[model samples]
Target: MIEVDEVCKSFTVRRRSGRLRRSRTLVGAVDRISFTVAAGEFVGYLGPNGAGKSTTIKMLTGILTPTSGRVRVSGLDPSRQRTALARRIGVVFGQRTTLWWDLPLRDSLTLVRHLYRVERSTHQARLAELTELLELGAFLDTPVRQLSLGQRMRGDLAAALVHDPELLVLDEPTIGLDVISKATVRAFLTRLNTERGTTILLTTHDLGDVERLCRRVMVIDHGRLAYDGSLPRLRAALDADRILIVDLARAAPPIEVDGARVVRTDGPRQWLAIPPSGNAAAVVAAVAARHEVEDISLREPGIEDLITRLYGGGVPADR
Candidate 1:
């Protein structure tokens, strides 16, 4: 439902020099990035701060023009047919609200219905469903400024979908939300993608959101696409070593296990890095034979760690 072909976007940023001298430089925010999203797929666009994620989203939503290349959302060129494309897409920016601040939640939704030219009956039905699903009935009459952060976010989401757009572009939709609120938002988004077949492109710093909701993820760094594919594939590619942490009942002599490296040792606990090709069972057996084992746990590197390594310009360590 979304196709971006070698899209490039740059901003002219002003730089100040000594003695009040100024210089204008073109900072490339998105450079030659290309990807396609199929209908009904929920994809996560992930990166660190200033990794061009927001720039790409803005270009896709027609909020900013690209310096070169092409972008199409739902078969329409966003820059060329912005108004027409807007009707086919819904965008929720976490730090910004599209709803009228002075209007009640219900009134704002009504205004959006009129703005979208939705039929009265269709509007009412959609509103009713959204109100029930989003649990917005309690504060339907509350002004935007009076609602809590979580409530405001839910209301924004509802407003974005009032016209039933085919595609949803959510930028940091769950940022700064409490755990319960985050779970609620994630559940709603999952339902929207699974039940309604809404094409969703999400940009989030929260790795848990990506891990739980997105099957496909695209990682960007330094204005370029670093990785794009199934989340499992990315994880497998980055984490080639399985880690085992063993806690002993008492400190024992330094032990050696074939094909495993001793990564760290602290008192009675030892950390071992097992290569992907190595047999973890053999290593465990060896450790068990030598040490008084109290407990053992295996872990793999998390997505957050992989992302940090990617942006930090270090190769992802093998699992």
Candidate 2:
């Protein structure tokens, strides 16, 4: 449903030099980034701050034109066919609201319905469904400015989908939302993608969102494609060491455990990263034999650790 071919976006950024001096440099926000999302697939687009994730989304949504290369959504160039493309996609930017601040949520969504030129009957039906599903009835008559962050976010999501777009693009859809709100949004999106077959391209800093919603994940870093595949494959391919966390009865120098590298130490606690193929039992036995182990546990590496590895030094690129 979406395709990017060698897309690159560079901006002229000015840096302050010495007093009364300045320097202009071409900053590459996205560099030759290319990927494709299959129709009806839930995909996560992930990157740290300044990693070009937003730049790419902006281009796809026709908000920003790519400096180089091409972006196609639903086989049409987003930049050139923006108006037409608008009808095919629904976007929810967590930090921003499309609803009118001073207007009641109902009015705001009503305006969106008309803006999309939806039929009256269709609009009413969809609005009813959205209000019920998003549990917006309590605040449907409430002014958007008065709604809590979570309530506003819910309103925003409902506003985006009033027209029932075939594709949904969400950027940080759960940012600043409480646990219950996040869960509500996640559940809605899950139903949207599964039952409605709405193609989704989600960009988020929260790994929990990605882990929960996306089966296929794409990692972009330094404006380039770092990894693209199923989350499991990406985890396995990175082959990041499994960590063994041990707390000694007394504070001591980093545990001299064999077959594991001490990655971090906090007085009584030490974190040992063992190779994926390394035996956890053997490492635990070795550590217990040498020290007064008060507590020991193992934890599998998570997406955050993988992204850290990417930025620390790009993980060996795997598609």
Candidate 3:
């Protein structure tokens, strides 16, 4: 469980002017963002670059202090009780590694276990489970530097979980991973959340990660919370228009469907944006009856498009 109440974080960076004059400028990395994650919930935090997602995560994980407001992880204030809170949370940053480069994967995990003061038997048991679940046995003896990106990511994830933390904070966990490797990581996370009931807060640029792994999502933009709710709700709210692609037997003149606007035209194929209130089945029937159609397909807007629209200042309206 995690609770963040109107948390705000800002950074003062040095700005240089002409003639070598310098001044400090305060930039808000996170601006009064608030959300809560219940136990066993896998929530996706998503936004474009510099959207304050990482800032919020750092504040919750105790890596950075907030300028104002409050954050509590498992009933402990991370800033004031960092050590106690650290033991109850696991963090994996896709851009960084927690393991020492020269250390073998097993050795890194062993070190983490000792640092967390995990009992030997408990450590061994957890390690075994993680190794099997993460398929780390293939390269357990490989040094961190020698492993491939995928292997290193798995090693980092295993290290984070060795102490059995209740909450997992993952920032771009699947970045730069190949398809197979991404699937493996997602499968492991699915099992972890389903079986162990670990609360997971994942920040990712990959909408596929959110689609596959999270039922709920929180979108942030311009250092503020833009949207927070079930993924389906967000999708419905942003994508009220459906796309209808119809291919006629031959090239047809431009024509419009009632309550639908022509969005694209290519020879015989025409794409129309149909209002959600319009009957798609009736539209398709009308097209088929009026024209010699070869094929037709209906598509809803994708999550990525919705995110883009949200960042582009589109108003949120229900489908």
Candidate 4:
């Protein structure tokens, strides 16, 4: 569904060097990154601030041309065939709304139908389905300006899907949404991908979304592809450690264990970093022998912890 081959994007920006002097420097937003997304697959694109995630999305959506290399979506070059590609892809930006501010939700959807040149009957059928699926019937007649953040987001999702695009590109789709709204959106997306076979490429700072939705993930750092694989492989490749929170019967020094190291200590509780392959029983026994143990629990490494480790230059060369 999407392919990026050694793509690079750079921009020239001016910086003040002196009272009357400005220096122009070239900045690389995406630097020779290569990856592919097959049809019917859901992939997560992850990176921290200024890590070229948005730049890559913009290129894929034809908002910006790459400074070097190639970008193709649905077998067409996004830069040269943007108009044709638009019909096959849907984009939702959490920070921006596609609906007209003063228009009611119904009117905005009608405009979309016209813009996409969807048949009257087809548009009506699809709108009805999306309205039901996204639960937009409650605010169908409400002005977009009057809708709450969650309401506005649901309305945006409906607008993006009305055209029946083959690919859905989402950027921070759950940002600022309440817990219930986020769950609703996530469930809808899962159904869309599984039942409708719509390929998805999601980029978000929310690890919860990735943990629930993405089986495959790609991490980009400094505009380069640092890791590309399943979540399990990522954890193994980075040698991520499991966390053990042990609460002793009384305040004591950090627990001494051979396979685990105390990473944090607070009162009677101590957090230990146990190797992914380490024996939890052995660590617990080792701690219990030395401390007056009261409670103990194990937590597997989360996506956030793994990504933080990867971003800190711990990514394996082959991952």
Q: Estimate, for each residue in 1-319, the C-alpha lDDT of model 4 and write its tens digit.
A: 9999999999999999999999999999999988989999999999888999999999999999999999999999998999899898999998999999999999999999898889999998999888888889999999999999999999999988888999999989999999999999999999999999999999999988998999789988888888898988898888889999999999887777799999999998999999988999899888888888899999999878887889885575463
Best-first order by TM-score:
4, 3, 2, 1
Candidate 2 C-alpha lDDT tens digits along 1-319: 9999999999999999989899999998999988888889999999888899888999999988999998999988999999999988999898899899999999998899889999999999999999888999999999999999999999999999988998899999999999999999999999989999999999998878988999999998889889888898877777789999999999989877678989999989999999988999999999999899999999988899988876776666676
lDDT leader: 4
In candidate 4, the residue pairs with backbone N, CA or C atoms under 3 Å apart (3 or more residues apart, or in different chains) clash, namely none
Query: How well does each candidate superpose onto the true structure, as a TM-score?
Result: 0.88, 0.90, 0.90, 0.93
lDDT of 3 at 287: 82
- Score each candidate by Cα lDDT: 0.89, 0.91, 0.89, 0.91
Q: Over the stretch 30-92, how does candidate 1's per-residue lDDT look in tens digits?
A: 999888899999999998899899999989988899899999899998988889998989999
Report the error of model 4 at residue 297, Å. 3.9
lDDT of 3 by residue, 37-150 (tens): 889999999989899998888888888999999999999999888899989999999999999999999999999999999999999999999989899999999999999999
Clashing pairs in 2: none
How many clashes (backbone N, Cα, C below 3 Å) per candidate? 5, 0, 0, 0
Off by over 4 Å in 3: 246-252, 266-269, 278-298, 312-319
Q: What is the lDDT of candidate 4?
A: 0.91
Off by over 4 Å in 1: 247-260, 265-270, 277-296, 309-319
